[model samples]
Target: MNWYQTWNNPLKNLLWWLVIIGMLGSLPLAYMRHETETSTKNVEFVFDYRDLLDIADLQTNPQKFVQDQLGKMKAAGIGSMAVYESTLAEFKESRRIDLYNSRDAAALTQTFGDPSENFTYLLFTNNEAQQKLEPLIQKTFADLGVGVKPWSFKNRSGLVIQMSPDDAAIKAMDPDPIAMQMLKDQGFQLVVRLSNHREFKSNDMDRLLKQLHDLGVKRIIVDGNEVPGYTEENTEENLNKMADLLNKYGMGLAAIELLKEPQKGFSTLAKQTNYNVVRLHSFTEKDGDKLTEPLKKSELEGRIQGVADRFVLAVKDRNIRMVFINGHAVKSLDRAKVVDPLSAYYESLTGTDGAIPRIEKFGFDLGPAQPFEVHTTSWQKVARVFLLIGGLSLVVLMLSFFIPEGTLIFFVLGLIGLVGVHVLSANLYAQGLALMTAISAPSVAVMLAIRTVRSGASAKWKSGIGFGLWLLLRTSLISLIGIVYEVALLNHITYSLVLQQFRGVGLLHLLPIAIAGLYLLFFSENNTYSEKLANIRRILSSYISVLWIVIAGVGLAAVYYYLSRTGNEGQASTVEKLFRSYLENTMGVRPRTKEFLVAHPIFVLGGYLAVRYRHAVYLLFIGVVGQLSLVDTFAHLHTPLHISLLRIFYGLVIGAILGLILCAAWEIVARSWKRWAKPQLLK
Candidate 1:
């Protein structure tokens, strides 16, 4: 019969259309249900654009900036804010600019910069109060003459900032001598040094220390050099001696002079001796060379924040309490010292005058901050729907057997409809359990019905057996094809590269083919006692193929593990290295290949022998092993090349072997059946 003739059979055509249409319609509903169910339970509020604001800049316009930020918070339904600062010098020194330049506006808003120029403000209220705050904050910013634009909004978490100090003006303010004296009088440790001019004699150092002591200054930082015209070595020795003298005097030493090179060794010594603070000199010529023109505020914040986080971690590790952050390299050590430009910029962007729409349009409210609440469906509802669909499919399957011949088409249609429902359930709800239950229950029912309908009469029994066998073979082939398709698709140059390139996602693409294999196995027929025994023998033979592939996988894993652990390249050949690399990159876990081979040599050898003989059971075993390895490998590894190549090779090898095996098995079964029938005929 032509393909069209078979497919166009009125009953078959109807079943096919029913199956296709049902599956197509159900998927979207299932996906929707799944998403709704998953989302309802844990509603988290994420900040929309966090990095856009630089806290350091907020010091320039604290009130206006904060009010503007408050407006965004009101719109987004954000309740709380956390603020941190990064040093200016680090910001200029780092690659934050590149990062900012590469990112889109949305990404640009996630990080904040230099806390010294900013202070965090959080708005708290019930949902109603929050709704009122957005417009109010916007108007407030407009009244202050700060151009407010909407930057981004979040439903739950948001950040805001306030004022910063002026750098140049603060730099001009010198320490008051009386104020210094008063601090000394209060028994506080005080260190004073000239901002410039490094040269000093040992006698000069002594006079300075003595003068400070007379003034009740308990601690002093002086030029490290003890004598003018001293050699570098002498200068170094003098500095060390001066440090020791300070310790002896029960005082702290702060080095005012910059070391020619910042030595890790000297830093270690200074740390050990509690020299507490070591000030770096002006930015080196090399540093100046590295600085780029037109420093972006976003880039500056990222670099600054990175340094701050690192410094915090380092200081915490060392148990250090106070560290002086220089204005030149570290920016502001205290928030009261510098303006945060980025924060002001962010406020301006997120203000009422901003280009972006109000937060409500984006499914959020801004103002009095409140806990986020997202609309979603309950899992119980999803479960009930699934149960209803499954029960209906089961009922249809049971009715198929007891019904008349003409009604078979209706039963088939119902089965197809159930399959459609399963697909729909999967797509809409993403509930694998529901879909599986729906699909499997109907399949089981159909098998049972077929078994029952064929049991009454001899002719009917013969026809049923033949049809069952054909169905088994068809299902098995289809399942094998699905497996091969999956494996072939996976074969690529690099699994990671493949994953990186993946953009399209279709509903049918996501289903696991292994489930199809299981379905085929469950529906397969073994009628007579001899036929059942033959099936068992075939299954046993298939184990041999599985054994061979398992041995290979284990062997490859062992070599990879040994190579990786020992870092010994010489032990493995190029081919072995390639294979090992593929396995390791494809499968995160390394298997013990050598050990497995040693442990199961008999099984491995038998499986290999069966493959050589083109045994169908062995081929099936090989395919299963390959499928399992591919699945496990894909699950663990990020690289696609290894996965793809391994899958393709596995499929091709297993498919070829299995095809031959099936042909041989069919021939053998046919011959045996014929011989048995002939004896019965002779009788």
Candidate 2:
């Protein structure tokens, strides 16, 4: 036995006490988080007005089609309409204006086309359109060094632009005030869309925003990858100006979920506005088409249901409070008709067990999403200091397993480094400490489980089940402390809203298992560190075999496969997805498959058999997966706290049950082997 194993090891006791203190200190922060999450339960459903116009343009009477769709959407509980900045092409599609090229204009007048002057012409549909658009067009074009002049087409007022049709088509125009007023009058909230295509001056932005604010617009979603004020010429300075205007108008931004990268100026704007942002999930036109392509009735219904399922997950699990839905017209060759998924989308929201009702059942109601009111308190900072020391202790505890005599040395150095990091960058310190705790707690838990199993190596069947269950509970509790420290340390609204993430997830996933494996091979089985080194040297000096090479290759492949399944982009098979859906429907929270099906079962049965067969200690390496997964579950900061808690509970209860079954089955197999197969093989 090592001197550190003595009962009076003061350093060991101090580390454990710090871990306990850290866990207790984090409880208040957890309660505060619960308060923050429950305060915002309103979910907004937004329809893409541009998408509606595009689909309407496909109909025989575009005006009638749009009115019908808007009424249907309002009936289907769409509370908001997302209106984009207009282009000339979009205006033509909306039937607000008619466009003619130079040749067409010349032909209409029965005059030859001018060889040197190719110009674009626009004819308003009515006097109202002419009054609203003509001056706006003239000023916009005049500012861009393009000439605009009054013209007449028969009895209608029109404008002539010196630029060609293509150039005129792409120019930026403000969102149509007529449409905005109509939608607002129709009882729809407007979510204005902004683009940075045109250079925005402070005064221009202020004017545009003031007009929208007067029309009762409360939120803006960007039209492209960059926010409205983000440009190559000026970065965050422009964002600050935009944020000031948004804040002045009492408006917020809708942060889109799962973008490949965040909008360039999003963080600056969000921070400047005190994080007046709500998470939005958008299902694009292409996504709708993918679900309905080669559309069979049964297939369409199933896929639509799939969309409802996703919306529910987004609201009830992730903190997505706004859903932006887009659709396109599809040509149905089988029926000889053009169709859009608008009705189908309506069904997904209004069906008996659809997203709306499901989300409401989870305590969300249909309304504008409220942003998190993040007000920091003095106590949270004090609590984090405790959490930091606890995290440092966990790192030292795990190190003690490998370097038994260096516990005090490691803890002192870790303390100094953590304090330095915290002073330099609190965010960096939080993430680093969170990662250390995440890796250390799981590795320490698995090591403790191995030691417990070793001490009970001579236990009988009567004690095995109870002993294994106790170990499972104890090890999980240790791993859960890592989660507590992680949550408390990084418990800012930015993490809850996913504006910042817990870094080093890849390292967190890999290190615990590797450490547990190292402990299993060298530190367990009553061997000293020097003796373990001798065994390694003796094995290296021995002959290399083909079987060993094959085993090494297989191990490397297994590691590769494990890593591929770790992050958000992990791939899953069709059958697995179906099985997951089944579990989600049947169980309120689906336990992770790796936990209940694989790791927990092995841990349980391995605990039982390790007493009888020393070789079974190796199973604890695989068992470390369940422990680390418990910690990793909370790393998804966007998932609701209660949902994460429920998920963890389900995983533990289900995993424990499955593990006992494996133990029972193994007992039966071993008895049968002893009775017949083992004796025969011995002969």
Superposed on all Cα atoms, the candidates' RMSDs to the truth, in angstroms, are 27.6, 2.3
Q: Candidate 2 local accuracy as lDDT?
A: 0.85
lDDT, candidate 2, 1-683, per-residue tens = 46544532678878899888978878788777777777788999999999999889889998999999899999888999999888788879878899999989988888898878779988999988888878778877887999888888789999999999998998997888889999999999999999888887899889999999999988989878888888888777888899999999999988898888988888889899998999999999988886556767888888878888888888888899999999989888977888788888888898856788878877889998889766456688688778877788888889988886777778878889999998999899989998899999999999988876666643644677776777788899999989988888878888888889788888888899889987776776677778999987887898889999999999999888877777788778888888987887677578888888888888877777776775677776688999999999899988878888888888888888998998989889989999999999999
Candidate 1's displacement at residue 29, Å, is: 7.8
For each candidate in the order shown, give its overall lDDT on alpha carbons: 0.34, 0.85
Worst 10 residues of 2 by lDDT: 1-10
Model 1 regions lying over 4 Å from their true place = 1-54, 57-435, 438-515, 518-530, 541-547, 550-683
How does model 1 fare in lDDT?
0.34
Q: For residues 145-229, write the lDDT of model 1, one tens digit per residue.
A: 4343333235532223131212211121122333345334433344444221324345544654565556544433332332222
Question: What are the per-model numbers of colliding residue pairs?
Answer: 68, 0
Query: TM-score per candidate, in order?
Result: 0.23, 0.96
**Against the true structure, whose lDDT is highest?**
2
TM-score of 2: 0.96
